[model samples]
Every structure is written in C-alpha cells, then in structure tokens.
Target: MCNSVVLGVDIGTSSTKAVALTLDGQILGIATRTHQVDRSHPGRVSMDGEIWWQEFVGLCTELSPHAPGGFAAIGASGMGPTLMLCDAAGRGVAPAALYGVDTRAVEQIRQLEDAFGAEEIYRTGDSYLSTQSVGPKFAWFRQHDPEAYAAARTFHMPASLLVHRLTGAYVLDHQAAGQCSPLYDAARHRWIAERCELVAPGITFPRLAWAGDRAGEVTRTAAAQVPGLRAGAPVTVGTIDAWAEAHSVGATEVGDLMLMYGTTMCLVATQDHRVRHPSMWGSPGLVPGRWTLAGGMGTSGAITAWVRDLLGGSSYDSLTCDAAASGPGARGLLMLPYFDGERTPILDPSARGTICGLTVRHTRGDLFRATLESVGYAVRHHLETFHEAGIVPRRAIAVGGGVRSALSAQLVSDITGLPQQLTRISIGASYGDAHLAAGLLADTPPLSDWNPVVRVIEPRPEPAYDELYRLYRQLYESTRDIQHALAARHSASAGEPLPDHRATATAPERSVTAPERSAPVSPAGPDTPRSPR
Candidate 1:
C-alpha cells in the first residue's frame, strides 16, 4: 500500500508541478515542467489549453513508476480566474486568456461598469471591474472576436479544463466562480444568470461545487491515455492555485494571510466576514462560511527571471549571493516592478517598469537586489490596504520558490514589519492539492499535522526601506503620464487597437482562426497556465 497514494497537480504561470503523496503526508515523488508564456503582442498573454492536459499526462507518466501500487485519488489546481472559452464538445475556441496579467479588456471593463452601476456591481460581485475579474474578459471576447464568442458554448479555467478532460465533468469550484465578478453573486454563492447573459450571451455556466468535493471519477478513455490510473478513480473539484496553496499551509483561519512568492506575488487573507475594497479582490473561501481578501502583483519572481536571462542566464544562487552582498536599498537603486503592468492598489495596465538611480559602478547584484526590494514594497502596499480595511493579519505565512531566498523574504518582512511563517514543505500548490485529495478518504490525517511551521522570518528594522518605500509610492505618480503615452505607442506600433468599444465594431472583418498549437515542449518538460503562484 506504500505505492497507493493521492496525486496533486498545479498549472502555474511559468510552470506545472505534480506530486504523489501518501494519505499521511509522505511524498513519494514530484515532477515540475517550466514553460514560458506567449506574448506575441503587447498587453496580450495566453497559452494553449492543450498544453495543460499534455503536461498533466507527462507529469503523471513520470510519477507513475514511483507509485507502483496505483493511484487512490487526484486533486487539481491552476492560476486563475482565467478565461478559456470552448465549444460544446469541450475543445478550446482560442488560446486561454491568462489572469490579470493580460490587459486587453480595459474597454470591456468600462462598458460593464457603465451598464451595471459600479456600486451595484461591487455589491453583487464583492469586487470592482479590474483586470483580475473574468467578466471583462468575456465582454472583450464578445466585442472583439465575435466569431469565437458565437462558437463558445462553455468557459473553463485551467483547473476545470483538466477536470473535464480527466473525468468528463463540466464543473467549476465555487471559489473560482466568485472571482467571475458581476457574473457571480457573492452573497448567494452562485452565478447570476442575468448578468451572465448580459456579458456573455449564449454561454452555459458549469455546475458549481466546493473545491474539495469529488468532481467525478476518471473516465475509461482518460484512464487509457494516462498510465497508472484506473477508470473510476475519484477526482476532486480543484480551485485557484493560490487558494489551494493557502489550504496546504493551514492559512484558512481568520486573520491569517498567506503570502505566495512565485512568478507573481499573491496574498490571500482569510476573514470571517466578506470585505469589499476597490483595489483588492474579495471572494468565497475554499470552504463555506469563510471569505478571502486577495491581492497580487503583476511581477515578482518573473522580474528576477528576466534579469537572470538578461545577464546571460546565470544561476539564481549566484544572483542571490551577489544580491545579498549588495546590502539594503541596493546601493541607491530603486525599481518599479511593473514589467507586465501593475495589479492591486494601482491597477494600471499602462504602467511600465522603471529603474531609478543607476550608475556605471553598480553591478548586476544591485539591480537584482532592487528588483527583489521592488516586490517587497508592493507587498507592503497590499498589506497596508488590508490594515485600512480592518483586516490585520495575525499570522503571515510565506510559501513558494521565492521563499528559498533569505534575502528576498527578509526584505518583505522588513518592509511590512510582519513575521513570516515558513512551512516544512514548500513544494507549493501541488502539495496542497494532494492534501485536499487525501481528505476525500475517511482515514486522512489533519492537514495542520501534514505540514508544520518550520521557522519564522522576523523583521530586522531598516530605516532605508521606509525612505525607499516613500519614493516608490511617488515614483509611479510622477511617471504615470509618460508610461501611458509609451504604452499607447507600443500598442500602435504593434497594430493592436487601443481599448475602444467602437474599434471592434468598425474593425475590418477577419476570418476566425483556431488557436495555434502550443510551443513544443522543452527537453526538460511541459508548461501550464499563468499568474503569481
């Protein structure tokens, strides 16, 4: 029975990870595949939905040998509230539009606000119309790609896409549904059919279920395509990767903030009552009777990876070591980590990355340290919003690959003055998915016991960080107009229309093309969806 274990998989922005684990929380094997997002045009980020299933098959195939006894159950997760419209037969109509990072729906957001008063939209959706909301993307499709919208009979996020492929189930978790802003009624915990019809006419909403509930059993056809799993193995209705990561670290209690350090930085603060703010997102928690206030930065580890690549693909360890030596404030360097535009508190899709106070004497180390500190300031901005909303966190838990760097974690702690709790396992959302799968069994152990707090990252006061943060706030305001103008120029040069409702109406007719095939999988492995964790 040692080989009989539950499986968990998460499709993230930059990679896909899978893990096999015993019911008692012992990991048998883990696999990860890193891939890049497609950015053929400015403000557009997407991935082939087919890659999500392909990576799942690859990961399961790689882990199958280690689990000789056979699989017990499966749990799935991915970066979301993404928009992947599909036909009635379940094939993707187009490449999946990623979460907030893809900022092509600005006009759609405004249209929704105008149609449904902003106040009423927030009252129903628990959030304002921001890039993070899925509703605007739906509107964007209807307005821009009428053919695709006409063909789309269903919508799927990464988790639901995998679930449908595995179990032949057409369903989405309630937590994911809540993020569909204006289309979902947070108070009622269900889709608002009227609003759905208004934004995305002629679409069918998937059946809704709790994140941990069993979605369905693996169909015989799916079992044959993927080795080591028999037909009828239970599959849980998985949720957004960040929420699953939150559950993995036992961060579901009121006043517990789960800070995820990954491709993008995300924060999920559990609360007893729903709290609505214009800048942050509010959604139903993984379980009933709980709510979460969430916020995310557009770039975190992504910027560091960019810097590494720019410096001829040096090892991250070397970069971290050099960054540590650069000391606080990065020797008079400050950066705005908005390479993909900003999200949360700022919500500016036109914002571009800015580097201030650069000198020829400064090394790559100083630039890298400034990048890390930039994320720290962003974290502070989000946490300050939480405080203003009267949702101060009693405990802040940090997880993901970025947490491995003491320099980065310390910078966040120093900026926020909040101690960060580190768990024994930091494999990320995949570990959490395994825990959720195990819960379906009657004999599963408590999740808190599965992964315990290994250490606490305490803040060492740094006066320089305070002064730098002040400048960070001012930096964005001072450069807003220039960034907007440059963003417009980039769009024009790319032949991409600026956000305008009339542009789609007046644009020349073009034949609808099928989504392009995903980039060939690298020798190392396959890829998955987008967003922070």
Candidate 2:
C-alpha cells in the first residue's frame, strides 16, 4: 500500500510556501510564491486578503500534480497574529493590518490600556498590549475606518482566513487567539467577550481549536478551486507560523528555544508552565497544556534585503561573502536593527533604525556585515531577557531561510554563546504543518525520525564581539531620543498623526453601528506589486 500523504501551506510575510509529504516524512513536492507587504506609507504594512487565497490556490496547482496518491489531510499556517477583518461572507473589509512591524495602532494601544488597566490586561492575558496585539488594531480600524468596521462581522488572521476559505469554517487556533490580548483569556483558553467588545464591539470571534485539531474537511467548492486537494480531506487548525516553525525542528520540548530567522526574526521558547513577562508574549503552545514565551525583532532579514537592494541588487551570495570578510564588529560599526521599530524587550514603536561609525572608506561589505551583526546583538538582547524572566532555554534550534547563511547563524551563536542545532530538513513552518497533519493519523512516525539534527553550531567566544555587544546596548539608550524625534518627523512628513503619548482619556466612545460615510481611507495603503520574501 502506498504511504498516505498530507499537504501544508504557509502564508508568510514575503511569500507563500507549501509542502506535500508522506506520513513517514518523505517530501513529495514543495512550492513557493513570493509576495510583499504593502508599505507605501510609513508605519503601515499590509497585504490584500485576496493575495493569500490566490497564492494558496497557485501553490496547490503547482504541488498537487506531484502527489499522485492524494492527501489524507491539509494543514495551513501563516504570519500572525494579524488582523484581517471580514464580512460574514468572508470578504475582507479592508487590507489586513499586519503584526508588530506595522506600528499604526499606537494611539489605539494607549486607548485600550486606559479603558482596561494595563496591569489587569497583563495579569489576565499574560501579555501587555503593544503593536503585536490584535485588540489595538481592531480599535484602530473602528476609529479610523468606521465603514469597514461596521461591515466587518468577524476578524481573521492569515491562518484562520485561509482555513475559512478552504474548509468553510470560521475558526482560529487558541495560540493565535492568545495573542489577541484582552480579547482572549490565556488561562481560560477562551475569548473574554466583554473585553473583546470593549475593543471590537459586536464582533463575533471564530470557534477556537488547538493548532493540530481538525478544523474541518475541505469543501467541494474549495477543492475545485484549488485543483489538487481532495474535497473530503481533513484540515488541521493551524497556528502562527513561528510556532509551526518551532515544531518543524522538534523544538517543542520544554526548555527548547526555536529561533526563526525569516523576514522577521522570531523567537519561541517552550515552557511547561506559563511564564509571563511585561515585554515578551506568553501564548498556548501547539499542544494542550504546553506554553510558550515569544519575542520578535521587527526586522532582521528585512534589513539585509534593504541594504542589498540599496547596493544595486547585489546577489545574497556576494553580499554574504563580503559580509563574512568584513569580520567581527564590522570594522567599528554598530547598528540598532529597529528599521521597523522594535517588538520584544523594548516594545517601542517609535524606535527607528540607526547606524554608528561610518567612514568614506567603508565598503558595502561593511554595511552588510554591520546589518548581520546588529541582528546578532538583538538576539542576545532577547536571550538575556529570557534569562531575566527565569525562562532560559536549555537547547536552541535555528530554522528558516536565514540559516542557509553560515555567517549569520554562526554570528548569532557567537553573540549569544549558545549552541544552535541545525536540522536536516529545514523547510520551516510549512513542513511542520505537514508534520502536524501526519500526526492526526493513527500510524504516523515520530517527528524525530522525520527531521534530525545534521550539525551543531557552537559559540566561539570573541572578546571583541563581547565589547561590541555592550556598546550596542549603550548605543540604543544614547540615541533613543534622537530616533524617536526622527520617527515623529517622518510621521509628520508622511501626513500621519504622531502617537499621543500623553493624551488624556477623553477620546469619545463610538458605537459599533455604521455612522455617516466619510471619504474612504485605506488603513494600510494601496495594493502594491508583489515582491520577494
């Protein structure tokens, strides 16, 4: 008998990827479609909801032909916790408001904090409201785009949105819901309806399920639209892409940290019990009774891409080679990797990227190396916070496209002084989604057998790196005020309102019902052409 197969698709920040694999872990086929967030406006980053479904369909068309025996189940994951408000018919009311990288909700964040005490939110949700929380984004939509908000019957993240289109089920994974903050009660594992109403009045949340639970079977309409998928195949309720990426490398064990180096640098540390910190996020794990402490840098690989493009589209291979040659400290250069503000630890949206120590003699290589080293410093900063919160990881697994670069991974290890295990199969979250789907079967093989560690990157302590890291921290503190002022100027020039940091709690409470129709405003920006992930 032929081995059964499962398919997994992930909508990422810069691309959509899919994989078809058998129950025993052989990859049958893989496909990817690149896309970019629309960033035509400062502090606004998003993508059309239509692009997600179209790309999923495109991936299915490309991979389905290779899966001759067909699939037993289909799983999906994506960049989240994003806010994609949709009507009852599942049409997106507006472009999705992306995660922490899009810092357009600063005012709304403060508004929600005042309405519900910040400490109470942290105590109940196990996380503080920041750019990452979906609650604030909802408030931003209601206040800024009342027409869309009035039409929006429900809100969906990338994962949930795709699941709804595929299975005709309006469901969200518990892990994703936990990131909604104030709207979701982490301990209770359910929506706090009253609190949700405070931010998203009259909005109905989708049914919640574990990431691995079967959300529903593929509908005939969806199957026909997607070409390769079978109508009756079971679909797993997928979670955020970072969690799936963690599971991809078997980094789900307690005290294991999965550092995903993608468009955004994300860190997920597995914990047996809830570990809450004001800076980091605490969410339910892929499996029940499991928990995770998470942090993400607003940009990592994104910064590298920007530098590469600015240098006239140099190939990444050439850039990496040049960066590697630049050596430790990038020749006295230091960079704060806050190109899109920052997420973890500091949680400052007004923070801006800054580079120090420039010279006329500096080459593009030096700039590239500085960018890479800056990400390393940011990783160390987050790891230090993990230690301070008493949630240190015993083992670290590195996964994502960035791991293909030895210099990048080694720099991270050297800076953090932690051994990072590299898995043989590092296709990332889509592969993990397939693993989760396979596990839904009775006779699935162990995940360990599927993906094993091929090599370990041990830290090479360099005194120069240590000194640079110390200065990297100081540089941020010394220049934070300057960065904020620059951010304010950028916002003003873009005709964007600066966040009212000291505004009184006098904002009028608006009803959920539709009011007078004003000029249509795009919350993020116009749909831009697709770009590479």
Q: How far in Å is the alpha carbon of 410 misplaced in model 1?
A: 1.2
lDDT of 2 by residue, 1-533 (tens): 25677888899999999999877788989999998889988878888988999998888888877666456788889999999989877899999999888888888888888899877787778787888889888888888899998888877888888888878888888889889987877776777767766677767778778899888888989877767878888889999999999989999988999999999999999877777667788887887768888999999999999999999999999999999899898987899999988888778877889989999989898999999999999999999888867877899999999999999999999988989999999999999999888777656665677899999999998889888999999998898778888988988998987785222112111111111222321122111111111
lDDT of 2: 0.84
lDDT of each: 0.84, 0.84
Backbone clashes in candidate 1 total 2
List residue ranges in candidate 1 displaced over 4 A: 1-3, 500-533
Runs off by more than 4 Å, candidate 2? 501-533
